[model samples]
Structures are given as C-alpha cells and as structure tokens.
Target: MTSIITHNDQELLKLIGERQNHQAFEVLYQRHFDAVFRYVFKVMQDRETAEDVVQNIFISLWKKPPSLNHPTLLPYLFGAARNQIAKEIRKNKWNKEQLDFIENTKGICSTDEYLEERDTRKLLESGIQKLPQKCRNVFKLSRFSYLSNKQISEKLGISVFTVENHIKKALYLLRQSIEFIVICLVSWY
Candidate 1:
C-alpha cells in the first residue's frame, strides 16, 4: 500500500471526502497546522484563542472537506484562517490594533501575494464608496487626508467619539468587502 504521506493535498482531500479516511485527515492537519496556527496566533495575540480558531478550522475541514480544483490546500487553509480570525475579532470586539494586525498580515500568504496591487486598490476604493456618506467622509479624512480623530471631529463638527465610531464602522465594512473579493480571487487562481 502507498503511504498517505506521499499523497498530495488533493488526493488526501479526496480520501477524506470519499472514504472518511482519518489518516489522510491527520496528514493534512499535520501539514498545515503550524502555518495556520502561527498565522492565527499572530493576529489573535492570544495562544489559547488562536489554538481554538485553528482547531475549529481543522475540525470544519475534517467534517466537510471542500471540493477544490487546485492541487494545493495552502490558499484555502490561509483563507479559512483569515476568515476565522476576522470572525473572532468581530465576535470579541477586539481593538483596532488587532484589526490593523490582520490587515497587515493579509499579504503574508502566497494567495494574497498574487493579487495585483491595482486590483486591490480598486476594490478598496469601491468598498469606500459603498460606505455611508458621513462614514465615508470620515474615513477618507482620517485615512487619505491623514487627519487625526480630533481633527476629523472638528472639521466634521462631530464629537471625537463619533469620528472614531465612523472610522471603525468604515474599516469593518471595508475589511468585509475586501475579504470577500480576496477570497473570490484566491479561489479563481
């Protein structure tokens, strides 16, 4: 019998999907756990939560392995980790620092590295356009114009808290929108 360790990710996935092969599942888990865990840990900044998120990712994969045309599962795994981290951030109401951390980490994987810079810029612009008028204005002022929260508040005649809230909402919405696009792009390639 051929060793499952020699099988590629697609073959392993097929084994798991069609035969419910735990060994194949274990192979995949062992192959990806460290990279996925490291990514989740970096973004989460909490070992236990990161482990939980990574564990859930593998659990979901084991439960229903996705049918992918691609040979490698790295993109899918990274994408799953990204989504899981985002969900955790939203659920836990993590601070902006964590959000920024995830944003910076997006290009750490090969999947995101393949995105054209111009395409990413366009998607970000589109997401910004989709924001509410005031929120959009605040985001632009803060991000584009390099204005501080106090400066944005004074210019918009809103309180600093309101300005901060607008920026957060804009970021949350933009992140969701851009993440969806990135996922589609990853699946495409």
Candidate 2:
C-alpha cells in the first residue's frame, strides 16, 4: 500500500504541473478531495451535487494543468469551485421553481396522502438502499411483514439483538437522510 504524504497546496501544484508526477496528483486528490468537496458543499449544500461538482473540478484539473495565470493554484481551484457552485445554485433555483409550480398546480386531493411527499419517500428509499443487504432485508421484513424483532430474528436465523441492531441502524440512516433532505428543503429559501 502506498502511503500518501500530506503535501501543501503549493507542493501539489508544482507536482501536478510536472509531466511525470502522477503520484503527487494522486496524493493531492486524496488530500484535497474532502476539503474542496466540503467547500463546494457549504456553498451548494447538496451532497450529490457537491460530488458532481468535485468530480468535475478534479477532472478539469487533470485535463488542464494550472497555467502561470493561476500563481496560487488552491485558491484558483476554489474560485473555480465557487463559480461552479453559483451555476449549480442557479440551476437548483430553476428546478425548485419548476417543482413548486408542479406541486402547487397539481390538486392536493388528486394526490394520495402517502405519496404527496416525493422527496421524503426518495430519501427513505435511498437510505434503505445504502444499508447492507442483510440489514435492508431484515428492516423490510420487520416493516412489511409487521413482525416482532424476535420473529424477524427467528425468520432470518439471527439473534434478536442482531435484528434489533439492524433495525436501529436502518432507522438511524433513514432519519439522517430525512433530516438532510429537510435541511436542503429549508435552505432552498
């Protein structure tokens, strides 16, 4: 396993600018991904969107090395990210407007109460999707089959505590996903 050294941004830029410094770029990628991503996320405030922006930023960096125009490369990258984030904000605004329009115009009575909130449902579905397969199956069995934890454990051939733990983890992830969605929705304004 190649251990990564923590290179300062200037060191990274110099290495990245070199033709044979692939390892340095790799190290830089590992080092700066989280910081740059968090910076983008702070502005964009959406993980999926931030991920996309981060990927794009790194890709552009690889494709086009920093020229002399960017004497300070980290800030240059951050500036690029900021610009990308502004574009994303504008796009999100347009999307929210369209979503709101559709939601408002659609008769509330026409929608089933359970189905009216797509974002929440998607959040839950995504949370469930992220679970380990066993945990997901156990959670579904408990929820859909309406079985007690003991029953679920028996059916799954696992201990009751395991079943309970799986269910708890699933619920925790779902709650977290929902909270994130709620925060995003609230922050839309």
Candidate 3:
C-alpha cells in the first residue's frame, strides 16, 4: 500500500494522465477500495451487489484513467456510486412493474402510481410534525418508537381502543396531508 500524499490526490491522476502509470493506479485502488466498497454497501444492501458495483467502478477508472481536466477521482467515484444506486433502484422498480403488469391485466400501478406512492410516503414522513398531538404521539410510537399498541396503552395509561383509534387517526391524517401536498404540487406545476 502506498502512503497517500498529505495533500493532492491529483499526484496519481497526473501520473496516470502523463504516462500509463499502472503503479499509480494500483495505489489509487488500494486507497479507494475500502471507501468505494463501503459506499456501495451503504446503498445496495447486498454484499455481492456492492462488490460488483465496486468492480465496475474501478474498471471504469482504468478504462480511461485521467485527463488533463479530470476532476478529483474520489468525489467522482462516490458520485458514480450514487448514480449506480439510483439506477439499480429504478431498474428493480421497473422489473416489479413489469411483473405486476404481466400478472394483473385488470389493474396495475403505472409509472405515475409508483412516483405518486413514493412522493406520498415522503410527504407523510416529513409532515408528521404537523399531526395533532395525540395522533402524532401514537404515530411515533408505532412507527419510530417501535412500540406495540398494547405497549403504548400501558405506557400512556390509556384504553387499548383509544390507542388503536389514535393510530388509525394518525394514519388517516398522514394520508390526507400527503394528498394535500400532492394536490398543491400539481396545481403549482
């Protein structure tokens, strides 16, 4: 393993750009392998997928090592990882849609359905802050605090029915709020 220069990752980039500095590439790989793997694993959730992404990322690096205007390779690698994650997510989503379309001729969520579902979920997550106090508390317990309704009942010293109602109302309010946001977005756009 080569020691990283105190400053300037471009040392390796420069070498690779000027001449086919294979050793410099080796140095770049060693320095960046762990970080790249960590990044892919953070996104992909599967070790095998992460490993494959890392391999692809490096293969790209070698295919065209560096140009005079090359940006810092470190950020470029991570940015590429982010793009790969998005691509993988979208690919899987489309695959699921394809399966659903084949299996259910009567009804299927189109691309709009998936986008709206995702946006609604995002809105609900962000708008929980605006829920009525009791409803918000129950929602947090069930979703974030990871408490069963029975446990929530004990903790809040409320009837089980009340806890259940709180959860129901919370969900209703969340859905309504998200719907409102979606409507607003559509109107504005």
Candidate 4:
C-alpha cells in the first residue's frame, strides 16, 4: 500500500485513473470531502441536497478521473459543485432571481407587511455587516462575486480550505444573528 498521505493530487489521479487503486481514490475523497461538502452546502443550504450532490460528484470522479495536466483538484471540485447546484436550481425551476422576486412580492398585498419585510431585510444586512472582516470578504466573494473557493483563495493569498471555513463560519454567524433578530422582532410585536 502506497503512503497515500505523501501523494499529491496528480499522483492520486494517476493511481486512480491508470492503476485503478481504490485506496488512492479513498485518499482523494477523504482529503477533499469536507471542503466540497461545505462548498456545496453554501449554495444548496440543505444538508440532504448537499450530501447527494457531493456524493454524485465523488462518484463521477471515480467513474472518470480528470486529466493529469490539470493544475489543482480544488478548482475542478468547486466547478463541479457550481454545475451541480445550477442543475438542481434548474430542476426545481427556482433560480435566485425568481425566488427573490417571489419572496419580495409575498408581502406586497399590504403596506404593513411590506414594511415588515423591509425591516427583516435591514436586520439581515446589519447582521452581515457585523461579520468578522475576513469572513465577510470570503462570503461576499463566494456569494456576490460568484467566485469559487479556488479563485478566492488565489485572490486573497489564502488556502481553499481557509476560504471554505470562512464561508461556513460566516453562514453560521449570520444564521444565528438573523434568528436572534427574528426572536426579538416577534417579542416586540
């Protein structure tokens, strides 16, 4: 058994593609699973859906390992996540724009409801503003700039794993902040 720990991505790919080494593949999967899962979960925001997509991605990798000439595995994995998320969005017929419009229109039937919606949005924005600087930057790059983790990593001079962790942390903090805001608003009303 090779010391899979010492194998770089190309070595791992070669082992999987040519030698059909299951251990090499398992090593690759173990190395990247958390980052890939976190990346997909950031987009899907549903544990089950993210798990399924990550599973499909790893399965596809096993079926067809990418070429050895490719630079790093992180970009390819993140691209696959983006593509899979896009496919799921298409399958559900609910792109973000459409979802945003639907959500915006929900309370348009009444002025008070519209005001409440505005307040909720403001609260969410405030929560975002309170994020730690790096976390906020990573989150914006991933969500607003639509940059993959690899891109953000390169641009920020950080690791892909760091980018993923920042994003995950940002999401957790934001969710908690929003939930607290909701509770406060409910209590006040």
Top-TM-score candidate index: 1
Compared with the true structure, all predictions reach lDDT values of 0.86, 0.69, 0.69, 0.79
lDDT of 1 by residue, 16-41 (tens): 99999999999999987876786777
Q: How well does each candidate superpose onto the true structure, as a TM-score?
A: 0.56, 0.42, 0.42, 0.50
- lDDT by residue (tens digit), candidate 4, 107-178: 233335434745776787798899999999999888756688999999999999999999999999999998
Give the CA lDDT, 0 to 100, for residue 174 in model 3.
78
Tell me how candidate 2 scores on lDDT. 0.69
lDDT of 3: 0.69
Model 2 lDDT per residue over 1-189, tens place: 334365555666666777637777787688667656766665554668889998889888876667644223445656667667656666767356434433343333222432354455567778888888998999998865457898888888999999999999889888887788889989997
160, model 4: CA deviation in Å?
32
The candidate 2 region of ten consecutive residues with least summed lDDT is 105-114
Q: Is candidate 1 or candidate 3 better by TM-score?
A: 1
Better of 3 and 4 by lDDT: 4
Instruction: Give the range of the ten consecutive residues with the poorest summed lDDT in model 4.
Output: 102-111
Model 2 C-alpha RMSD vs. true structure (Å) is 14.8
> Over the full model, what C-alpha lDDT does candidate 1 score relative to the true structure?
0.86
- Which residue runs of candidate 1 sit more than 4 Å off their true CA positions? 111-189
Query: Residue 54's C-alpha lDDT in candidate 2?
Result: 88
Error of 4 at 146 (Å): 22
Tens digit of lDDT per residue, candidate 3, span 85-157?
6566667763454333333432323345445655765677787888888888888987755578999999999
